[model samples]
Target: MSNLLWLVPVLPFAGFLILALAGKHVSRVWVAIIGAGSVSLSAIIVLMIGIGFLLHPPATGNYSQTLWTWMQVAGFNPKITLFLDALSLVFVFVITFIGALIHIYSVSFMTGDKDYSRFFACMNLFVFSMLLLVLADNLLLLYLGWEGVGLCSYLLIGFWYESEVNGYAARKAFIITRIGDTAMAIGLFVIFYQFGTLAIPDILAKAPVLWQQGASIATITALLLLAGGVGKSAQLPLQTWLPDAMAGPSPVSALIHAATMVTAGVYLIARMHVIFQLSPIAQMIIAVIGAATLFIAGFSALTQYDIKRVLAYSTISQIGYMFLALGVGAWTAAIFHFMIHAFFKALLFLAAGAVIEALHHEHNMFKMGGLKNKLPVIFWTFLIGSASLAALPLISAGFYSKDQILWYAWASEGGNPWLWFIALLGAFITAVYTTRMMIVVFWGEAKTEIGHHPGKLMTVPLIILAFFSLFAGFIELPHNFGHFRLFSDLLHHVLPETVLKAGMDAELQFQLLALLSTFGGIYLAYVFYYKQPQRIEKLRQSGFVMNLYLFWFSGWGFDKLYNVLFVRPVVFIANINKNDVVDKLYQGVTFVTIRLYRSLSFTQSGSLRWYVMGLVIGAIIILSIQIML
Candidate 1:
């Protein structure tokens, strides 16, 4: 099984290469099968191995396979190795499972498109890169996969290269994430310099020794890595690109925003839990950033009319909650939330795709009322997804994961009650926006004509994800109810358990807090959107509130700020250098040289007498100088 682990990423990459190189000549059906089939096969293998590993666990609790020596230098060798442990197994299952579903959905969603082959090629490549990211045993190999996924994101986001906005959106996602990638690369270098290796397990093993020697070194390294995570996860200041990422096809949006790329940051921090354990300050920063991002993105999501953009902002916010969990030392809880979040979020986005397809690409909720009967499959799937996202009690997978995170936030070592308060507020906001979106899009009278119903291919994935969204939470039920802590225990081998455990009484307090937050959010959404939709209209009419809403709607004006601070200034400087500096200096030098040569050329005159005199004069001068020497 370990030996075969390499095939999980290899098969998809091979499919991508074959389809990409020969797709133009191949039939579209073959291309679809090759593209989707490659990932599906990998998913099947992963399921088999994953189940076997889970049932008959390894004694050492890890399985490693080194494919080959990727690079070797003096005392530095980074092998292309695949590792399957509790952590990597979870991510691999999600990447392959949700990834395969997205691939299947793309087949019907993208049928008859001219560049269908190219789209599938990029999708397969994305799965390959994402799999490598999770499976790699060393930081160098992980970075290779990291950059590979980013490249695929840029490719797939702008899959329809003919649209200038699509190309622009792709560039935005690439450049913004690159900022974090650069920071992360530097952090990796810092780790190597301090620890003298790039192997992840080795680094984690040695982190405690380094921390005990000099705690500041560990803090700097951890913070730098967090910076990288922030960028990749679309947290806080680096979150503007995600909303605009909707320019891609719906399946691409579902994959990038929901399943794979955006979650890389959370995975990174969780992967380096050892380093993070040493830096309390860094952890606090992570928590605070996560809280801030949740509030900002939640509020921003409330204002979005574009269906995909709303879901995009919601992703940022939900991932922020996961970061908050990680920051608060609830590593198991964070990953638990990540697993459940993947199912519901992907379902929501895919369901949104179905809605758009039915409404002839209409995305605004205002234009999408009363779709319940018109698209029954989409409505039921979306309801299950929305219920999970809203964290409805007992029924929602999000209820289990999110409740645990909030509980940990209030009870963990160094936990602050205020952070929990803010998180609760964010949760309410999440419910409100999600409810408003659903009501406006599916509950009211039909505002647009429904063109066509979605095919079984699309709805099947939605139905499967919906089931998970509803019931996946039972894997981590609270202690008061018999304490089925399967998820936390399964993940303990990989994640660090905090020394300070919350008291039993504190558990009840945490539950009350979570219930209030969840119900408050639902109530606000019902009151504002369902009971009194006119209030939203009135709020929209207010000048101040309208401007505030607009600002949030535009991603807190980060795009404008980037344009002014970076883009315009760089363009202006380039223009000035091109016209005033380089042209003037270079052309001026050329003009002087030309004029000097012309003036000097008059001495030649092209005459035999002049040539003879010039030669004699030159020889006399040379002889005079030689005589003086």
Candidate 2:
């Protein structure tokens, strides 16, 4: 089973190769099978190996398989190896399993599309890249997988090449994420230079001996890695691209947001927990960024009218919770939320896809009304996902995962009151936007007629995901409740246990406050959007409120701010240098070469005497040069 680990990523890569080679010639049915079946097979392998890992833990508490050496230079040898442990196993399971489901859903969702095979090819490649990312035993290999997903994102997001807007969105995602990728690359170089290795186990083992707590070197490397994570995960300042990324197909969004690309950063932080632990400054920065991002993205979600755009912002906000947990040393809690988030966020995106398809490609929630009755499957599944996103008390899985973060944000040794308050406020805003989305899209009068209903192909994945969104929390419950520790206990081998700064006496009080925020946000959304719509309209009419609404809707004007700060200046310089010194230098070389060619052409006049004379002149010149030398 351990040796077979290579098959996990290979299956998807093989699928991608097949589809890319013969896709145009194959029928759509075969395309679907080749695409979805490959990932499905990978999922089965992961599940079997996962069970083996649990039933019979390895002697080292991890399984590593080295296929071959990747490169060897200057005594730096990194192998093409896969490392499987409790942590990477968790991510691999999600990437393969949830990824398989998304591919299956894409089968039906992409029917009749001209580029059906192309879409599946990019998807399989995307999954392969992500699997490699989580499975890599070394940072260099990990970075390869990281860039693979970035390239695949640009390909899939702008899949419908006919759409200019989609192209812009794809470029935006690629270029912005590249900023973080650059930082991560530099971080990796520093790690290798300092530790003389990029292997995960080696780095973790060596970090403490090499750098003291809060050392400048440790802090610098950690901050650089965090910048990379922030960009890839769509955190503040680098977050503006995600909302526009909704321009891609919904299944693509699910893959990127839920199970793969966006979560790569969270996995990075968790995977290299020792580095962050050694740098308290970097850790605190993570918490502040996470808290601020969640709050900001929640407001953006609130202002979105596009259904997918709302979920896009919701993803940014949810990942913020994961970051918050990581910053507070709640490693298990962060990964736990990541798992639960995968379930519900994928459900939401797929369900939203169904709605969009049924409504003749309408994206605006205002145009979508009374869908609960029209599309019961999507409505029910979407409602479950929404409830989970809102963390609706004890019923939804989100309550367990999110509440854990809330507790740790206040109770952990690294946590502070201010972090807790910001997180709590973000939770409330999350609920408000979620409720607003549900009402505007699923309730109210029917504004658009349904064109079609989702088949079992599409609905089954939603049903499966919705079940997880509802029940996955049972594996890890609160102490005052069942105190189930199955999830956290499994992660104990790889991640350190979170230490509490306070006793459990205030747990219930904190839980109650979080519940109040959730319920209050829901009730407020009901009042403003559902019950008295006039109130929302009137509030929007107010000058200040309207200004705020526009600001949030514009994603806090980050795009405009960036344009002024970066894009405009660069464009201006580019325009001024349209034909600058470098161009003239090249043009002069071209002019001289053309003149020489013309001068040389006079001797080639189809005359044998002229040709012989030219050869004689060339020989004379060569003989004179040799004699002089």
Best by lDDT: 2
TM-score of each: 0.93, 0.95
Where model 1 places Cα greater than 4 Å from the true spot, the runs are 499-501, 580-629
| Residues 431-480, model 2: lDDT tens digits | 99999999999899999999988899999999999999999999999877
Displacement of the residue 608 alpha carbon in candidate 2, Å: 16
| 163: Cα error in model 1, Å | 1.9
Q: RMSD of each candidate? A: 3.7, 3.6
Worst 10 residues of 1 by lDDT: 496-505
lDDT of 1 by residue, 331-405 (tens): 998899999999999999999999998898888888889988888889999999998888887888988888887
Span of 10 residues, lowest total lDDT, candidate 2: 497-506
lDDT against true structure, model 2: 0.94
**What RMSD value applies to candidate 2?**
3.6
